[model samples]
Target: MKLSTVFYFTILFIFISSASYSQAILQKNISLDVNRQRLENVLEILSNKGDFYFSYNSSIVKKDSLVSFRASNKTVKEILTELFNNTYEFRESGNYIIIRKAPIRMTLVTQKGITEEKIYSVSGFVYDEQSGAAISEASIYEKKMLASALTNEDGFFKIKLKSSKTSTAELTVSKEFYEDTTIKIQPRFDQQLSITMMPVEIPENNTVIKPEDYLAPDSLQVPTDTTEQQLPVSNDSIKVQQTGVGRFLLSGKQKVQSLNLKNFFTTRPFQISLVPGVSTHGQLNSQVINNFSLNIFGGYTAGTNGFEIGGLFNIDQKDVKYFQAAGLFNSVGGEVKGFQVAGINNLVQDNVYGFQAAGINNFVTGKMHGFQAAGIYNHVSDSVKGFQVAGIGNFSKEKASGVQIAGVSNISNREMNGVQIAGVVNYAKKLKGLQIGLINIADTSAGYSIGLINIIIKGYHKLSFSANEVENVNAAFKTGNSKLYSILRAGVNLSDSNKVYSFGYGLGSELSLNKKKTLSINPELSCQYLYLGSWDYLNLLNRFDLNFNIKLGKYISLFGGPSYSVYVTDQDVAFGGYRFPVPPSHYNTTKFSHKVTEIQP
Candidate 1:
């Protein structure tokens, strides 16, 4: 009796577990009542009450059609069957119920037994599963042999397949906006079949989330999918090639093929094309990633893995791996990993990892990790990690960590951590490096600037009044950091008999001598033109000084130092009302003076 009781309990437990595991969401009981509403709304109501979700294609079901139904304490399967008029099927996938059209039954028309010929033919007619209508332009292909054919207007297609050791071969039928269908058949026989295809379905909750949802309005963001993870060829994949240049270069048929064959891509060893739409691969060239591509005039392709050359221009919809060259221009919608050269321009919508050289310009919308050389302009929308050289100008919208050399100007909108060398102007929003140009501008700087005019918006600035041997009253303005500063100086002697005036430019460095910065040492060099009652003869004064600075008040300081001066003149007599400190020389002569400067407030 004990053994029998234990056996009975075990059996009961097994039965209950199996019942729970095998039960499907379709068998769930729910109550739904609608007088007249949209079919989509009705499905939503059912989903809410049933505590489940519905996944169906919008094309298969007329979402706007009026639907009226009543079901109380009925299974989901029964309700769906009655609601769709018994024309659809219900399936369970995870926690959601999938609604699809009922697949039409296929019948074998004719078949021939094994033949002597190695090549056998498979002829078929494709039909819609829901409406029982012929599906035209449906693609029928074999996987292993790469053999393919398309159905005509009458839905008739015939494809030849080579027989091998395998007894059965699989045939796949696909069309735009349709679910791919595959079937197995004996490879040795010539067969005729009737095939049916279903429409692809998307989850009702599938949505595309743009990057602006969490970013600033002026910031750039790429749109992404909010659904589950997917492979490279899913519907959620972005069409990066839908750009302004692509619209003008790529044909409409090529664009359509790119959209329809998102889940299909193959590799080819070589491809040749006279133009974009006219290629060796026909309209399917956009779906092929070739190892080698050559064009007589111009070409368009999905991508390049090795080498590609064109006579006029080259357009690639995807990434470039090794090398690409063109006569007029080269446009790539994806990342570039190798060398790219063009006669006119090189345009890359994504990042670049190698060198880009162009005759006219080089434009990259994403980050650049390599070098760029152009004749006119080089522009990077994001940051740069390498060098940029251009004849006219170079611009980086974000941070720049490398060197920028230009004939005209170099501008960085954000931080700069490297060097900028330009003939005219160099600008950085925040600088941590060095700048060499005629004019250098920075909002904030922790580095040095060597230019005729260095303007740091938030940097050091001070005006000082002092007296030197050359003139009685002197005034100077200094700007930049303690490490490096620029000075503009002018001095005038108020004596009515022998008035002297001077104007000059100089550079200085300040070093702190105490922890509190109360005492400091300053070294400066300046060259000035002295007006010693003469305008026809040259009167130049050059000086070097070592100053001791003592901070007195919050905005005041007392500074004095020893100076060395050299005076050169070529005037035999005074031309104006003033006379020279010493007798004027008939020939060029130098006079030296060494003295202590007078401290002034």
Candidate 2:
């Protein structure tokens, strides 16, 4: 009876203990599933905040309880603590806690301890619109602050910021000749932002003048008392009238009054009048002066007809057939020829030739070719070739080839073959002969040579030297056996006594500097060999020259120079006697030298 009773108790105890063990395992599994679900949900929320990864041991549980809870601030620590806390009621042999259903309070505590922590960063690129290409050297500025950065060659940029919650940032980029752009970014993991920029335009400079009205052709009806009257203009014929004695019409269209013409004179009209202002033959019928010319104060004209003195042309189509002047006054135009002298001014013109002279004045119109002189200045136009000399200055155009010399200056175009020398300056385009002592000369092939302090000779295969030094030479030839190539040399220094032979086969580059009117540093380098043979040494040398110079002016410079050279020679030499240090037959050496040379320009 005792043995049976003991067996029954033992069986009952075993059943209860086994049931408890199974229950603990089942509860722990369920608690683990709950914690896992909570962690996955929290992770999903945190992932939205930043990018991260997570891991933990599933076999571990919280405390001795089948369902225990572990809690901590860090994700890795929080996972371990939640397991231990949930299994505290069912401690196991393994490092893991036994699975158990923990109190709701403990589970809540674990979840709270495992709160997510996040960090955020931002980055991006900028580009050009039309080219679809990356824009380099663009400046990017943080809108809120003065801090800025330039984009790299690839147009990429990056920036860092700290954020506890979500935030927005603004960026501005700018470049020369390009419109600026702005961008807004939301804080997240790594974000990409790209932008494009456009371009800008430019504008020109001048003045435009418009005509207001026109004068009618028969409007000027002279009174019967008028001694010389101009007929009413028809479409084909324009009238001319002269009111004062010795009064004549010079070239160039003009409109003036008596106050403007105090001292003036007039001579006969030349065959062709090259008026400075525009003269429309069609406008003569309408009597409307649609054309306007400014900057004409006073002048004179003289030719084969009788001379007219002291007169001005106030209106169009006036003729001064025969007259001379010794007083102050004004009048206008036609057929005045002779030796007419005005105390201060004159205006003359006709079909043959006209001469006008005035004090500190101006003359404009057709060829007053024969003996047209001005006290201060004169200008002759039209196709008149004759002698025009001015006391102060003279300017002529349209084949005015005679000795058109001026006291102060002279400027002419076309074939000026004669010795048309100005006291101070002279300029002509096509010259048949010579130009001497001229400061600046620009003549075509017709001129034999130009002699001056400085000369620029431009041509193919030309050689130029200054006194004893060879300045420049360009020589080219075709070697039929091989190929054809040309040699160009510029800024070379060669003397008669110390000859410099420079043979440049390929491309050549040279740089020079001057100081105190002398060449300071003249460094020249060529792809091939450059030779310099002097009275002292015959050097068969290869030169790699680097020169720096300080130039004082066109004629003087000081230079400090260095050259890398490869010396090729068939001979070898020994040094330091017994040591017998023989340099290689072919060796490289670097030389440093300083030189000062005077350059003639």
Candidate 3:
């Protein structure tokens, strides 16, 4: 029983053990081969062309290195199929991959530097009107306070500004006796603009005077005497007499007394009459009287006479006659062959032949002839005369003859043949020349002339001159304030007789003192072109200005400043930037400086 059974069992046990060992060895070999194949695939993917970012789990891995990976399956089925008979297992987390080879690293680099900014500039001009003159020393600035420039003698200006902000720039211009101007500037890289300025109002020089009168009486009464033997007298008396009849009537405390006599003449050729508070006369020739009162005063004469009164009023004269009076008011005298007189307030004179006079609180009787004299508080005795005078508190006696003078408080006593004088207190009698007062007149063989404050005339000509210059650089030259003409002129020009032209250039600087006030400085250059006959002339000018302006109110301001100017003229010079041939040159240049203060009202 033992030998055969033992040998068989031992052989069977040995075969079983051998088969198990062989299986274990085959499984290990499969796993190694799968790992190797995976590593090769990962390496191939890493070494592919084109740039890419390399990433891994928390641990960094070198690029361009072989890596290993396996399918996420428990069985070795996929590993054997993909990696040639192998059995392996692997787990992946985020970007991590199980690999057999170490990784390689790579880096990149870059470079850097700096650049510059660019700047730009602009230029333009301004000009004047009326004489076609070049307005030098004109102010030029950016309307928005962004930039500014001024015109030179040729009304030219240059400005430097940032090119990037070109769209924001605007040009502004200002000059004396001309309104301000502004132009929109679209500076094309660097550009030049031409502009013009128009003339402004030219103020006149004049004076006005007003006078007062107090010697005016509320009423006046005059009485006359007549004989009842040769003339019939009735309650309402109406008398008809010849041309040469003298009558006197006396009444006792009468409420109403009037004389209706037409065509009555004085007997004496030259007579003098004096009365109380009032006096009445008709047709007196060549007579001199003083301190007389007239009620419904009337006169007609062919010669000369002088009548003076305190508050004489209402006198009428016709035909050629001359009369003089003083200190009269509210009277009328006119239509005399020689002269008539009425003086003071409400005094009117008309149609006089020779001369008439009137005074304060008095009026002219009638039309004046040669001349009429009246004073303030008085009026001319007549009209249509050579002259009339009426001063304050004074009136005319009859009518003025040669010259009429009217002033404050004037007086007239004797009959003046040359001129009449009326002032606050003045006198004239056959005067040849001198005249004085706030307003006075003197007339002889020479022409008549009137003056205020002072008057000195040479021959028949009078010379008057006025100058005004404003330098405002700091003020904003708003485009809203510029006119069309000012926007187009930018240079200086000159011309003769029939034709004219001008050009100008300027520069200006302004510092804002406040939102509304500013300090300004301006420099100007201008060149003028003139054509006389076939010749052309060129003039150069330069000016500088400095000013401070204060805004007093919305539409008003107080401005004051100083200025310096220069001008030159050349006979042989040519202009640039023009395609025309060089023309004949005649130039002029001048320099001046001054300080001024003004109140803009």
Question: Who wins the lDDT comparison?
Answer: 1
Per-model TM against the reference: 0.73, 0.27, 0.21
Ranking by lDDT: 1, 2, 3
Against the reference, the lDDT scores of all candidates come to 0.79, 0.38, 0.34
Please, what are the lDDT tens digits per residue for candidate 3 over residues 430-518? Answer: 23343444443222112222223222222211111112221111222211000100011122122222222333333233345565443
What are the per-model numbers of colliding residue pairs? 0, 101, 208
* Model 1 Cα lDDT, one tens digit per residue, 350-461: 8999999999999999998899999999999999989999999999999999999999999999998999999999999998999998888889999888777788899878
**Higher TM-score: candidate 2 or 3?**
2
Model 3 has an lDDT value of: 0.34
Better of 1 and 3 by lDDT: 1
Q: Score candidate 2 by lDDT.
A: 0.38
The sequence of per-residue lDDT tens digits that candidate 2 reaches over residues 284-313 is 111222122111232222112233222332
In candidate 1, the residue pairs with backbone N, CA or C atoms under 3 Å apart (3 or more residues apart, or in different chains) clash, namely none
After TM-score superposition, what is the CA distance of residue 234 in candidate 1 from its true location, in Å?
9.4
Candidate 1 stretches greater than 4 Å from native = 1-82, 91-240, 472-474, 490-502, 530-539, 568-573, 577-601
